[model samples]
Target: MKASAFVLLLISGLPAAAIAQPNTAQGELLRRGELTGSRPSAKAQMQAASRPANHASDPAQQHLLQTDINLAQARAEELPNLYERFMATTRDERRTWTAPQWDAAGEVLARLNQRYEQVRTDLPLDDRLRVRSLQGEFHTLRGARNVKEKLE
Candidate 1:
């Protein structure tokens, strides 16, 4: 009974050891060029080394990109304030915003839209879509204001 139990234990452990063992056949295949490792070849490594480094890490380029991003963010932040101010005015006071205030807002919107369009390719998809949505809102607000002005 003791010998039988020992034999059963050894038998159970054998399959696990077999599964854990690395296949020597894989090494043979690699020696014959039938299998490849994940690492790039020497030629590929040399080509990659010869290529120019990414410009994004350069201080001047990074500064310029950051500046543009800041300007875009500032413009985006201003939109909400402008909308709030426009909404705050009474119906009687709507005309007060037309010439100077509304025109300035329109100019800002146009400039922001142009800047966003110019950089859209550089921006991530979500940010590009956000800028487009802002542009649409600007147009909608401008149209509503125009209609109100015409009604008056």
Candidate 2:
């Protein structure tokens, strides 16, 4: 059994670049360290973390929504480079959960921000909260990028 596993590993490692497509968030996380063979687990955590709260109308909530939007846009711009960094440094045996979470978090922030933006503009709470949330995710992604670099 161990020998077969070794063969599988050897096969998977061959010409990795030729076999792989461009690296995206999902791809990077799935192919990295702890996450390599645990995609289902990583995906579930993301869904739970991103679930909407019950009190959408709260002032603080609104502000978070706005913050999330702006941050998402900015992060989206950096995603290409960020993804490259993740792929270069990450090994199949060292998949990082936080790195995958970073991608999921950014996506959730952006979606929430867009949703809140459609509502009436009079509520400062909404805009402020959204932007803050986005910023939080952006920072998270930035940190993840740094970790990936260090690993490299």
Candidate 3:
């Protein structure tokens, strides 16, 4: 009976020893910057290595980034015009908007929403908030238009 109890205690302690052994291997891997299962793919690792530590000194990359920013800004500037057209047509009192008019407005709103989402990360916090507010307005207008059509 004493031998059996000793064997049981030894078996239970083996798992604790196994758990402790992992710290040595994991610590060495951590020191070497080589993660096991979660290591980055070879392509991503190569890209990361090739990138300069100080990116601001890379003129070509800087130019490309600036060009992208300029294009995004240009696209963002068009939002106001699109929003104005949507409001003008939807708010006009001379006649109820037909299906085609609603379709056009929806298309414009979709475009505006897409552009905002694409460049929202680059926008200032205030601009991001404003874009969200504008999106909400677009959704409200769409709902109101739907209700009007249902009533008609």
Candidate 4:
């Protein structure tokens, strides 16, 4: 039983070491500029877009967009506290949160990012940079959320 347990542990440990090694084939190909994945068909991409076909604004769509804008603005306003809470909760190395909590945090971060993008576009370059720095906390929180989900 003891020998079998040791063998199991050894096998499980091997893949972690493998992950530490660089993939030479991928690295070389990336250096050569060879790439994979199909380019989106223009027609298909157009059809896939959520924007209206007529390019005429629909009231419902406009309302939804406005709501998105509002939510982002609100989040931007309260971003500091949200980040502080997230950090405080996750500060302990042994603390773990459920996937839902992390996912919600990620969603909030994405919303805050959208808000930041919109706000930045309306500001001067210098102000945009400052705002971006302020907004970075949301991105960090979102990343932590994703990490928590994956760890779970």
Structural similarity to truth (TM-score) of each candidate: 0.37, 0.27, 0.42, 0.32
Mind giving the per-residue lDDT tens digits that candidate 2 earns over 95-146?
4536555454344433333332333133465444544444444555556677
Candidate 2 weakest ten by summed lDDT: 28-37
Model 4 Cα lDDT, one tens digit per residue, 1-152: 99999999999999998886434222111111111112334543343243222311333222222322233334444433433443344343213645554444443333334334333334556654544544454446556766876897
Q: Over 4 Å off in model 1, which ranges?
A: 1-96
Model 4, C-alpha of 68: deviation from truth (Å): 14
TM-score order, best first, reads: 3, 1, 4, 2
* lDDT for each residue of candidate 1 in 84-123, tens digit (9 for 90 to 100): 3323332234345555555544433333333333334455
Which has the better TM-score: candidate 3, or candidate 4? Answer: 3
At residue 35, candidate 2 shows an lDDT of 22
Winning candidate number (lDDT): 3
How much lDDT does candidate 1 score?
0.42
TM match of model 2 to true structure: 0.27
Give residue 136's lDDT in candidate 1 (0 to 100). Answer: 55
In the order shown, the candidates' Cα RMSDs to the true structure are 22.2, 16.9, 19.0, 17.8
Error of 3 at 97 (Å): 1.2
lDDT for each residue of candidate 3 in 27-144, tens digit (9 for 90 to 100): 1121111222233455544543453333333333223223222222346555444444445545552146566655544534443443444544456766666655555665576678
